[model samples]
Target: MNQQQFSSSHIPGLDRFWAVIPAGGVGTRLWPLSRAAAPKFLHDLTGSGQTLIRATYDRLHPLAGNNIMVVTGQAHRDAVCDQLSGVAEENFILEPEPKDSAAAIGVAAAVLFEQDPEAIMGSFAADQVIGPDDVFRTAVAEAIATAVTNKIVTIGIKPTYPSTGFGYIQKGEKLEIEAAPSAFKVDKFVEKPQADVAQRYVDSGQHFWNAGMFVAPVRLLLQHLQSNEPELFEGVTAIARARVAGDVTEPMAEIWPTLPKTSIDYAVAEPAAEAGDVAVIPGDFLWDDVGDFAAIARLNPAADESGVTVIGETPRVYADDANGVVVTDTSRVIALIGVENIVVVDTGDALLVTTTEHAQSVKQAVESIKAHGDDDVL
Candidate 1:
């Protein structure tokens, strides 16, 4: 994963703008459907005929053209390459192991900075489902515009509910940047709150859902990384430098596993906000993390006859008065009768049956399986 893999010439309309997709995470909540070898990003959770990561690449292609880089685990190398075939082999920033978003995204910043010092990179999660391509691109345009001013900008989704699952971002005064009129100074970053506290924050009309989409000059991002976590910064920078020297195999194997495991929020965003060096651009578009089976049900349209949400390729499904999600990957006909808010996931080696009310606890089942030495299904 080095700059030498692709042409250095910038795309006409998207010069200096690089879109980095961080495609890590096993999505344990998704369990059987999403495995360590093939995470949620590799599946079409929305049943839209395209995988999540593929959709993400399509969404950002217009904004970045060929200036796209994906940071992912080495285990997913072949799968990611197949999905993102348009992306160059050198553009794929392969991580030796899971070290969290900081290392995943920091290495991308370092690589882009080494290749193009003036590069403004935007890191978007590869597993997120966002819609109305025009709206998302517009929001990203504003984020890029704000990032040009040397501020670390994040695209904040307008909260639709007081969700305890996602973090909240408090916005301060509106920024008057001509290119980004809807931008605002970030007041602070808040962790996921309790139900009551989340309600208050949402009612106050001052908070936005933290979607973890960051846009900043690669140099500025590295500078912040150096200031907050010098050891981690040194590790990623060394990898990037190695890439510049025409090889990253030695450095990646030696330094990657040793990098500190931390998200970009704690490594850079939160502190940058405290120092008044962060900004937020309102993301006025449909967005979903597709975190669990509940999200899967929400994303897929219900079957007309049975009112059930069915995903994956199945021979037949006979449902009578059933309402919920059913993810199948077998030839057997799934017949559900009088089930309410029930979730059924049938795979080759696993079968999960639960209700929507207990969707969040599906990860616990995965944990239990691990404890019982059942790693094959996992």
Candidate 2:
């Protein structure tokens, strides 16, 4: 609830930790409420009173202190700065355009390496909702400890269900790290699979949901990046060098767009795992990406006794035998009668009405809107 609450740190090597937040998704699956101008990270979807990005920063600040770095797109610069008040301007790495996670995290590693070669950088996406602060921080501390051994580390969430939506990390054996007791060698990374395969993964008890939270020493991360993607590594390093020398405007404009587009998982994590250089720490905490209306429904409490969840400043909503989620940014009164598992989001310019079962189809709707040249709403 307050910064002072999470300020104390007893974990070793936490002083050298640098938290890197990659905030670059459009979140098209949460359309209407989440758009190009304002992505899901900018919204408080969980009714927690803090924006997702702000909450993310709050969670990481205690571990990293003032060493938090946020890498985001150029378009959301002012909004991001407004939300993260105390973060230094120099700590914000603004990409001229979106180049996916590898470029964003790669450049941040390069920049932090220049500032502190011993920096232990942990990359967490800006939009994920993880909680019971203590548990999450503990896993991260273990990740930091494992990273000190010059191995790439990631905090994998202990699976709660057979979720076909998330990628899986197959943890191999216990890694003997004195500082990180729960560290395990990552055997392999698996793509999102069918329901039966997901069930098998969950049943095995050796697999964890890949939360995309990676921790590694800056120098080690750069070495893997250079080894795996030499061109991308070179480009990001040049931009980092330019920033240290003077203005990064020229170098960023020239190099950033040309960098190869890929995710850190594909570029470094998978390959590193194959080489037995990656470790996974099981995170026993609640986690969610808040991906769509269904996730929004899961995070918020029901409004009144009616089985409907309401968010934002909707004046009033009448529901009779209806169960669903409603997000309204306007004053319009909404009434639902006899409908089940419905989702209604009303922004001034766009209104999205869908069922929980059809939540993932919102992306298709967004694509149709784009095809119709409705960029104004987007």
Candidate 3:
């Protein structure tokens, strides 16, 4: 993992760069805490003062400046705007429905292409927690430089472990681009593998976790989309043209909800990789999608010898000899005594009590709640 690292001052920021944040996911894994209306990205999961999206913005502001656009569902438009007053009203790209990453990022790409035909945009998740801000920014700067070559570039996170929860990107020979010395050809993009298979991938020392952060020229991205998915490409292009014309309301309403449900990986990345049109830069910084309770616990500074991580502003949690976990989102007092390795999440409406081992099953609880017709809690 001896990838090149550069100081933030050394990395050049492109004026044509734009950051497209696709912010629409319930994060059902962090149930009770993460709701459909207010998902994980809207919350300060890191216990940092800023919300996840805000933190993401802060991290990218140095690289992309005010050239940022958030692509979110119509339902979340107000929240996204309220959370990001620094961004202009026109910068927000509200989708009519959730059509997954391809549509969301594609629309952003289309709009950026309209603004600047050669715009280089990086699509970063609104909810990821990076290990070091500098390393992340440095990797992105290099990715942007690499993207200028008209190739799809992604930050290939050096796999810390055999993580079954994340997709893996296999790297090929090193790219000889002087501007992006650490860049490499993407051999393949593999889906989430079984535990044993994940271990084998890690043991081989040729795989990197797919960080879901993609950087490329807008034209190149749309060209790939048009080549692999004409229908989707046409839909986004039409919407983008309307946006550029300043009358997207009617066309977007008619076009967005009908787009197919597909992730960027399946829709473009895989095909581009197959065509030898993708590049990956090794990223050694620690990155976490904060997918589950285990990942949540890892971010808690309070997870001490007793193992307790209390979230929220004024959560009244008292742990006497409690050893496991206690998370509260409300003002009500939660007392945990002599409990070890157990997770207690008390939202105002719903409460989740489970063990750390079964934390991944929290999504099942959300489904059970839905089955019980309790959408308000969700």
lDDT of each: 0.89, 0.90, 0.85
Measure candidate 2: CA RMSD.
Answer: 2.1
lDDT of 3: 0.85
Over 17-136, each residue of candidate 3 has an lDDT whose tens digit, in order, gives 898888988899898888878888998887788889988888877677788899988888888887888888899998876678999999999998888898888999999998688788
Residue pairs in steric clash, candidate 3? 324-341
Ranking by lDDT: 2, 1, 3
Q: Between candidates 1 and 2, which one is better according to lDDT?
A: 2
- For model 2 the TM-score comes to 0.96
Best by TM-score: 2
Output the worst ten-in-a-row residue range by lDDT, candidate 3.
1-10
Models 1 onward score TM values of 0.95, 0.96, 0.94
lDDT of 2 by residue, 118-221 (tens): 88899999999999887888788888889988889999998888988999999998989987899999999999989999999999999999999999998988
Mind giving the per-residue lDDT tens digits that candidate 1 earns over 257-366? 89999999999999889989999999989999998999888888786867898887754778888888889999878999999998999988899999888999989999
Candidate 1 Cα outliers beyond 4 Å, as residue runs: 1-14
Instruction: Give the C-alpha miss distance for residue 117 in model 1, angstroms.
Output: 1.9
Q: Can you rank all candidates by TM-score, best first?
A: 2, 1, 3
